[model samples]
Target: MSMTITEKILAAHVDADEVRPGEIIDCRVDFVFANDITAPLAIQEFQKMDIPQVFDPDRVAFVFDHYVPSKDIASAQQCKITRDFVRAHDLPHFYDIGRSGIAHVLLAEEGFVGPGDVFVGADSHTCNQGALGAFATGVGSSDLAAAMALGRLWLRVPETVKYVLRGKLQPWVTGKDLILAIIGRIGVDGARYGAMEFAGEALAHLSMDERFSITNMAVEAGAKNGIMEPDDVTLAWFRPRARRSSAMYRSDPDANYADVRDIDASALETVVSVPSSPGNVVPVREVAGVKVDQCFIGTCTNGRIEDLRMAATVLAGRKVHAETRLLVIPATPRIYRQALEEGLIQIFLDAGGAISTSTCGPCIGGHMGVLAEGEVCVSTSSRNFIGRMGHRQSQVYLSNAGVAAASAVLGRLAHPDEVVRAPVPV
Candidate 1:
């Protein structure tokens, strides 16, 4: 009868005290969301259903992130559609370029999500919100449409994969490195359709930003969700920001798990995923001399304030290679301002790096840093499928902020320790 965190949370939403994996359940939705890229389609479908009104305006959110500045007429039209929909529905949670952050980051910082809530977003990375102990996942536009009109949705409960993390991470090793090692060991799709529940002493040492990076990429492994149960760390991050307080939930001590992975956090090394697949990973040493044309540190994956600080530590006074382009993007406007106030922006500029507006720009290869034919890059963003960032022949090596900073300096793949420390300009 014991249940995991995902099971316990879903059970409450459906009036059950406990539910087993694979059970079909009709559940109440705590929130429904879609970004500029997905919301237009969801709204069109919602209109076809003859739903004149949204279930709850306050419970619905729309963010103008992806291509928000309107890369072209098409993107501009998408933004206009989302803008009108938010206005027509009186959606209070709506956010535009100047007003909001990336959808996942903004929602979390604005107090819209909390422990034990079921949040459905129209983007795959919605699972990122699960770091707060919520059962968050990406659903298709049609699924989002129905959730918007009826305030409910159906889901087949998924089994859980428990990860017990131990030990402290070595300096320069990060959650990105830890998760990359896991994907490398298990391969992509390792946790297919299963909930990835991370726990253990190591979780205590990771900040919410670091945990967000790990959970945000759960989809790359085909996981249904990636959740970390609430603790003192979670409480501290959520208490000041949560719009609503929901009772926290935890897995039963004897909870049944589909499988359990034990990881020694200290044993991890800087890792990178080779071009085309996140699972094709290796230590930085293996690819130490591989040349890269660009380096990117942004997107929902590693574009937080903490991530920027890591890169700053590595770049402080040094300039990036003249032949390599380094693009640094903060995930949200708040993070952008904080970086500026802290002079991280100035540091990057003095080091010959380019700072961009807070948007899902080059990470999606939409703009800001598109790769040319046969080019290669080291990036902190997730997903490097064939031509994921531009030209099919162009390659991308996935790494963390530390690797990204060092790689930019050498115009090739390198580790943080390999770079000579530089002094900040006076």
Candidate 2:
């Protein structure tokens, strides 16, 4: 039986010959994780199971990325519960405030995820690891507890939707723009309960960081998961960091797909998702001149070093608009250190942008750059739903880091070229 990469990984985990879409199968999980916002509840559930300890201490991780440094008493208590549980279990994978980054980015950086693996987390962006050709997805807190206790999860196989990318990307256009374009064309529920499989020669042009950005937002499209086949680029990024052996899987040529879409990458331009919905996307030029009170560049979606570099390139030799405030966040401690070494941190400070310790703060309306009522923000984070970043009436426009930086300088939604005379490389 021919199978797509998603099917292949799922089948291998279950010791099955092959698995079909919509079929329920019990499979072993390679890794399981939960963040501060979700882990506390998951821990409560895990305790109810009366399980002495996790299935495997090495395979379970707890990350304190959201509200790290504790936004308030309630959040502080939540972390305390999870901290107590971790200490009791003697889990070596716990990442506290100083060492924590976004769970999705930190897990990959710490070498917990790899190709042909099946992993789950309590957060929606868990699908982010599917970029490495892994079968990854988000689950509820209860489901996370079950996985942590049993080290196995039952999954209803998702049908695959293949996307072929042809041609080259335009300058300043990135994986973020491509995903926004996809979500705009297919609405939010377009791929509900399905797998989005990305392939085609254009994958060669995207860096591992960009690929992570694309997969990170697959949940926004309502997909069960998003994946890319392992190639030289994927191997190059994972081989050095891999702590365990990894198997690379590919879709059989004759594999069945629920749908196929071919994207012309060269035609794509820098685009942004307008207020309230990621599906509401438009070219940056269309929304140009709209006033912005804040501009944020960080999150699992676009907080990599590559993203920081892009923002810094646009902000160099210029000052942020006095009417607008800029916040720059690196996704992980390592990335933060790299940015400092590269002098990107200085460029942002010189441009009047505030830098933050690695945290998912403003991205979740937790702390740090929360929006005021009726204010406007241009962010590089995933999702912009109502009240997602702060006041329900506040608006968020989602864009790549370069666009966010350019918007910060103009005090409105603007193209990066407006700030830089030449096209900044992707």
Candidate 3:
């Protein structure tokens, strides 16, 4: 039976000869994780099972990110609960305050997940790992608890929606723009309960970091998961940091797909998702000149070193608009350190942007850079739902780091070309 990459991985995990879409199967999970914001609930549920220990300490991870460096008493207490649980279980993958970063990005950086694995996390953006060809998805706390205890999960296989990318990308246009354009074309529920499989010759042009950005927002389009086949680019990035053996999987040429969409990458422009909905996307020029009070560049979606390099290139010799506040955060300690070594951090500071420790702080409105009511912000984070970053009335426009940096300088939503006539070397 021909199978898609998603089906191949799912079938392999379950020791099955074949699995069809909508089929319920019990599959072993290669990795399971939860962050500070979601781990406490999962821990409580796990305790109810009276399980003395996790299925495998090495395969479970706990990341303290959302409000780490605890913003308030409530958040501090939440971390305490998960920390205590991790210590009790002697979990080897516990990431605390100083070592913590966004769970999705941190897991990939540490090589906790890789090709042909089934990864489940309590965070929606867990789909980010799919860039490595993993069948990764987000689950509820109860489901997380079950997976942690049993090392297995029940999944209803999803039909696949294959997106074929052809042609080269334009300058300053990235995977973020591609995804926003996708969401805009096919509303938020377009791929609901289906696997979004990305393929085509254009994959060769997208870096691993950009691929991660694309998969990270799969949930925003209501997909069950988003995945790319394990190609040379994915292998080059995963092989060095891989902590365990990984199997590479690809879709059979004759595999069935629920739908197929072809995208012309060269035609894509730097795009942004307007306030309140990721599906509300348009070219950067469409919303240019709209006033912005803040600009944020960080999160699992676009916080990689590549993203910082792009932002730095634009902000290198310029100053941030005096009326606007720009906040720059690296997604992980390692990324933060690399930015410092590369002088990316200095360029941001010199441009009047504030740098933060690795955390999801401002992205979640937990602390740092929360917006005032009716204010406008241009962010590189994943979602921009109502009250996602602060006051319900505050508006957030989602864009790639370059666009966000350019917007910071113009004090409004602007195209990267509006600020940099010639790109500066980072």
Candidate 4:
């Protein structure tokens, strides 16, 4: 009996010859993380354990990102708690405002994550790191606290859903659009408690950033985790940054899949997830001309150098519509610096978009650019649950950076090409 990558990795870490889905097993973790939103509670739980010290302080990371610059008094206290824990433990991986961005992006850019490693974070999008071919997932405060204290956690192996995607994507179509399409096709809970393994020849055309975008949204479909098989592209990205090398894992030739599906990548179009749920997706053209009060082009799901460049290309010589506020946040501080060096920041500023520090800002309604009552926003952030970004009455439309940027220019939902092909000057 052959095993999928998720099974193989779990089995190896648990020192088992083989493992099957539904089997509960304890496995050591390569990395554990928590953010300002969840770390305070996890810290309280960790203190309750009465451990002299954490299992390995180096293996644990604390990032203050959810409400950077501190949204309010309560948020400030939460960040302070994380800082106190870091100082007490002398944890080198722990980071404060400037040194950290979003925990998921910071970990990857700063070399704390890589292929075949098991990573757990107190963030649902922690699975965002799985783009590098790792078995990463998000857990609750209690599970994260325990993992921090004991350096291990119990997991019920998830059966695999193999997506054998094949075809070249349309020019304006992106990983964000592709994932939204998947969510639309499957509904939100389509892959509940399952591991999503993306395979097939189409993987060859995807960049590491693109692959990360796809897996980062696996949680939207209720998957336990998402993974990609490592090849030369992964090794190239990891070779220069990995602190420790681990054996690369892949599914066996005859690995059994719980279900198999195929997506015609070439047929995908830029799409948006309407307010209230990520699964409520439709093509960009369907929603074109829908008025918007704001547009945001960054989040763990679509915030990176590549995403920044795409948005800049759209807004290079244009200005944001007077009625719409555009906010562009890079996912990590390093990406922030790179954007500045490339003059992307200037392009954003000149185009009337506000350039902010790398923080989850506004994505979680923490601060920076929250929507108001009855407001409509075209955002590139993940999750559009009612009240997810602001007041329950405010609406959020989720789409790629291209669509988000274009919407800001027109003050209405539209595709990137629509703006470019228009007759009037932006």
Q: Which candidate would rank higher by lDDT, 1 or 3?
A: 3
Clashes of each: 0, 0, 0, 0
Better of 1 and 3 by TM-score: 3
Q: Which scores better on lDDT, 1 or 2?
A: 2
Q: Note the residue pairs that clash in candidate 1.
A: none
Query: Model 1, residue 159: what's the lDDT?
Result: 95
Q: After superposition, how far is residue 130 of candidate 4 from its true place, in Å?
A: 1.2
Question: Candidate 4, TM-score vs. the true structure?
Answer: 0.98
lDDT of 2: 0.94
lDDT computed for candidate 4? 0.89
- Candidate 3 residue spans exceeding 4 A from truth: 422-426
lDDT of 2 by residue, 231-350 (tens): 999998999999889999999999999999999988998999998999999999999999999999999999999999999989987889999999999999999999999999999999
Clashing pairs in 3: none
Tell how far residue 375 is off in model 2, in angstroms.
0.4
lDDT of 3 by residue, 191-243 (tens): 99999999887778999999999999999999989999999899899999999
TM-score, candidate 2, is 0.98
> Which sequence of candidate numbers ranks them by lDDT, best first?
2, 3, 1, 4
Per-residue error for 111 in candidate 3, Å, reads 0.7
What are the lDDT scores of the predictions, listed in order?
0.89, 0.94, 0.93, 0.89
- Candidate 2 stretches greater than 4 Å from native: 422-426
